[model samples]
Target: MPPPSAPDCYRVPTTPSSGEFRDRGSKFVAVLRPVRSEAEALAVVEEQRLAHPKCNHHCYAYRIGPGTDRWRANDDGEPSGTAGKPILGQIDKEGLSDLIIVVSRYFGGTKLGTSGLITAYREAARLSLLETVLAERVLTSPILLEFGYALMTPVMGALSQLGLEMADQEFTERARIKLEVRQSEREATVKELKAAIAGVYLAEVHDTFVVEGLTVSLPG
Candidate 1:
């Protein structure tokens, strides 16, 4: 079991995957995908709706962040907890996050009792995950770096030496840069930036932000 403390990386599906289940002529289609935020998750649901326009219910569950701290589950008109909860249960059972599972049900003119509905939804979610490739998602933090335009050269030198990349750079009388440092290395990186640019270049550390890496390469 992994420790309860925040982990450096979390498990997630490597790509979108789908599976289908049928019981009593009712068809349930499930798709699992990696999603970073609620907006993305909802967009996926919309896309699924477009794909399965004939489906009756589009139930779903999703979790975000390494800790799986933010999440939502929707039955989408299924009997109260019968659909959404079971799908979410599978996600939590797999110890996965930053992903969403959406199950579309096509009513086959037969009513599945509470137990049957739960079983169908759970099995649908499980089937999609069974075909998925799990991967480790690294954690990262974003820090905003600001300095006088004159200090660009020294700052660039420091970043190049550290093998760091700057993002969202804006130039004016003062220049602003956004940096994403690995969560575990953020403090050290911040210290290094200060040491290299603070006094000599009058660099100012205006703000700091935390974020997860959208993508990180895994060593072979």
Candidate 2:
């Protein structure tokens, strides 16, 4: 049998999601938010801390970038490996990146043991992720084309035929257009466009990233 195909896309939360868990009168509130960078993740954690100043503990876990190399888990004041590890484990189990989860605990005049704390944190994180709407995003690279006005017809036609969308454009003595093509289609798109329009200048790729093309339809 042929080898299994590698994944070309990834799932990400469309918006912030929240969940709550209660045990032995203690309240655990989980907030899951999609973030692109470490700075953004830290900012969200700070925001949560400020919002719940009375909370006894504010523990968090975050994963950023395309792989697991960039990630962190903070136990805060909780016992070692009780809070943050469980929260991070949940994120890894869900196969999610570019996300941060904060679990704030308010002591309810009761002390839950280590096992209880772990279960509560993990379940809270799982519930928050379950409540999120996830989108499948594909990676893309941008190409900027600058050509003479004489090539307008062919240039526009080539873009339309390739089903590529122009991200930006400028009309001047020379027409300038920016296009984003899927990384896998980059070479083909450039070859087709160059063949259609002579003297089409291809600029360096300005940016490369992933984006959701359409909303996923969930089953009832």
- Among these predicted structures, which one has the highest TM-score? 2
The segments of candidate 1 whose C-alpha lies over 4 angstroms from its true place after superposition are 1-8, 67-69, 144-154, 170-177, 194-220
Note the residue pairs that clash in candidate 1. none
lDDT by residue (tens digit), candidate 1, 1-220:
3344345777888889999999999999999999988999999999999999999799999999876569999999888999999999999888888889999999898998999999999999999999888878877788776667567776787788778997568888677788877788786777566655543332343334211121112121
Looking at model 2, residue 143 earns an lDDT score of: 79
Worst 10 residues of 1 by lDDT: 211-220
lDDT of 2 by residue, 51-70 (tens): 89999788999988665599
Which pairs of residues clash in candidate 2, taking residues 3 or more apart in a chain or in different chains?
none
Off by over 4 Å in 2: 1-8, 170-173, 198-220
Q: Model-by-model lDDT, in order?
A: 0.81, 0.78
Write down the TM-score of every candidate: 0.70, 0.78
